[model samples]
Target: MKKTIAGIEIPDGVMAQAATAQIRGTESELIFHHSLRAFLFGALIGYRESLTFDAELLYVAAMFHNVGLNVKYHRSPYRFEVDSANAARDFLRRHVVIDRLIDEVWTAIALHTTPGIPEHMSPLVALISAGVQMDVRGARYDDFTAQQCDEIVQAYPRESGFKRKIIEAYARGMEHRPETTFGTVNADVLDRWDPNYRRLNFCGLVLGSDWPN
Candidate 1:
């Protein structure tokens, strides 16, 4: 029996099941619940916008979006977003999903942390970001009815101090590769948590570049 919340049913496809198993098994309880809520909230946003999208793909993307933050990939030099995207891409490829579809998921996960851009892309890309924004940033918290918010939370039950905990997760994931967080919102995590952290300045890089005009 598939579960339903906020008028959206969990995708019961084989791919979704495999993705769910992996996420639930490997991710911390906070992440696993957050992943579920991201999918639900994202689906609700899509429903509100009346945009057509593949829920299964969205589920898979949501499940893997924060995966790079896992301890296994913490040492990688790439951005956690790219690392997470790679995990989704590899999963999709192994399932014989087409290259085109894989790219959509990959791009969605890669750009989930980026604001102001995913909204202009495909529905899948846009909604994934919107969902993330809603869940983490409360981008449009009022857009959803109070009941919907209550329902989703009741279903997933966000742990205590989610904001701080999430920031800690991001900081831990990227502390070893601070360069990757240079120009993205992830840097905010380091700035807040890492007392010795120095942010990279884009203008400074520009002025100091070796290319002389």
Candidate 2:
């Protein structure tokens, strides 16, 4: 039987179970819990907004959203988000998921770290971002009622130092691929965490280009 939280039954099926199996134990308790909360929050938002989406797909995307932070992908040159998204893509493909839906999940994970853009895309994309933002920073903390919030957190509790720890997790994940964090939101992690890391100025890049100005 699938668990229910805040009146929402966690999506369950062979595929969903497979996704769960793939992520659990591979991720730290902190990151794993956050990922589950992200799915539940996204589901709650979808219910609140009456948005239609594939729960299974959203669940898979949420499960794999931060897997790039794992040690296996630490050597990947791309941003952690892209590595995570590709991980989901590969999983879905192994399950023979259709290209269209695979792309949707890919986009959701790849862009979850990106704020404004995902929210403007499809419901699946927007809800994925919404869920992640809510978990990572409480982007819409007050949107849900107290009961909803309590129920969700009750099902999956955020650790005591989640805010600080999550940033630490991001920093650890991308510290190896610092160059990838250059223009993305996670760059802030390296900026603050590593005193030696500095963001490359966009103006500097353009002006320093080979084009003789």
Candidate 3:
């Protein structure tokens, strides 16, 4: 959607990218796509949820968060976010995104990895980081692994603060499970395969509808 945030007129290309990342199904694609969604949702939620500046920064960070997924997948799977961060730095520099915003985006992306980093200096970064961690760990209150439950308890040792509540909410939201299997019917995703239904269109998330302007 062509929504303006922080006075910057964001284009649909960014939103399309977000959608593309969302419907991605590959193991590699799944994580990066979730990262993008988390960022977008985090960004919008940041404003809609708490009117926080950090959330806005996180939203921006999420847009470019996984730009390096392809590169990292071809290189080192574990380094996806790191490579994506470097790519983001370069892209932000060229695109004239302010240095502080670049730093915040980079921080959010870097801290989103499993066993996440928590050195974010802003509330937005902290919030996004916490949300991402919750998603990676487990979103369901009853679904937490022993280790995950321990992590949750440690992450929110106190059960009565704004941060704790926000984190809990994020965890709850990330609990949704999407259908990831490839359909044998008339699927048009980029990765669709059909020897019988060879008339099917291209694979991957289809960008058929007109994006928001």
TM-score of each: 0.98, 0.98, 0.44
Q: 162-208 in candidate 3: lDDT tens per residue?
A: 34443333222222211211232112321233233233233423655
Best by lDDT: 1
Worst 10 residues of 1 by lDDT: 128-137
Give model 1 RMSD, 1 decimal.
Answer: 0.8
lDDT of each residue in 47-96, candidate 1, tens digit only? 88899999999999999999999899878999999999999999999999
Task: Give the alpha carbon lDDT tens digit for every residue of 130-208 in model 2.
Answer: 9999988889988988898898888888999889999999999988889998778888899989999989878999999
Which residue ranges in model 3 land beyond 4 Å of their true spot?
Answer: 1-32, 44-51, 54-56, 71-73, 76-78, 114-120, 139-213
RMSD of 3: 17.3
Instruction: List ranges where model 1 is wrong by over 4 Å.
Output: none
Arrange candidates, best lDDT first. Answer: 1, 2, 3
RMSD (CA, Å), each prediction: 0.8, 0.9, 17.3
